[model samples]
Target: MNKILVLAAHRYPDKSRISKAAIEAFTGLADVTVHQLTHAYPDFQIDVEHEQNLLRNHDTVILLFPFWWYSSPAILKEWQDQVLTYGFAYGSDGKVLHGKKMMVMTSTGGSAQAYTPEGYNQYAVDALLLPFHAMANKTGMLWQPPALVQGMNDATDALIDNGVNYWLERLQELRGM
Candidate 1:
């Protein structure tokens, strides 16, 4: 089975409902590590070498976060900026992530309808995630379709649990675990 690294980034852990539920669903699952970015670097200061080492150890990487302003939390962006250095995560000499699988696992406060072309956001989740796909391509990693939980702010406990189960099932299916 492929080892999975879940890089979770939440702005405020105390106020997190979806992120907490998602993490709980994956707890104790074999070959899975839930690394919380906010907890790891509270001050937004990232350790590039350490982050890269974690990447090198995982077979599949899942970026889990709540969509904020149509993008990831600032800390995740900072982590990306610092850790994904040239000649390391990209460039001719950057082959550490090559052939590995990667995907986004996210939740959005807005309803699914709001993310459509004709909706409020005027773009689908996949469209909003094009940059991630591009990053995966640049690094020679296999890009998997994202797993998302929509309308999270309005989601009930049962709905959140269902979303958690859905994500867990999808990940297991991907790894045949």
Candidate 2:
């Protein structure tokens, strides 16, 4: 079974709706660890060594966050900047993340239709997330297709429940990969 590590990054986890539900669903799963970045590092002081250790220990790394400005929240970016170092993630001797699988699971306020060329955002969610794909490639990790829950701003309880269920199902499926 693949040990999965979910880096759940939300700026305000207390006020969160979708992200909270997703995290709750991820809890208590075997071979899965859901690390809430905001809760762990409210001051944004990341422990690089510990983060790297977590990466090294897990077979699959899932980046869980709410989409902001067509990208991840500030803390997620900061975590990447601090933790994914040159000599650790990508360099001559930096292959700790090699062969690991990466998947982005994000919730967006915008609707699915709004994330297209003919829509308001004018770019597909996958296109906007190319940097993550490239980063996975650079680190030698297999990039899995992103799991997105869109139309979040007006989502109902039922919709959120369905999305959370789907997210849990995907995470459960990763153990077999």
* Top-scoring candidate (lDDT): 2
lDDT of 1 by residue, 2-118 (tens): 999899898996578878888887768999998999999999889888899999999999999999998999988898899988898899899999999998999999999999988
Q: How far is candidate 2 from the true structure (C-alpha RMSD, Å)?
A: 0.7
Candidate 2 lDDT for residue 61: 98
- Scored by lDDT, model 1 comes in at 0.89
Candidate 1 TM-score, true structure as reference: 0.96
lDDT of 2 by residue, 11-85 (tens): 899788888899888888888999999999999999998999999999999999999998998899999999999
TM-score of each: 0.96, 0.98
Worst 10 residues of 1 by lDDT: 168-177
Model 2 collision count: 0
lDDT of 2 at 59: 98
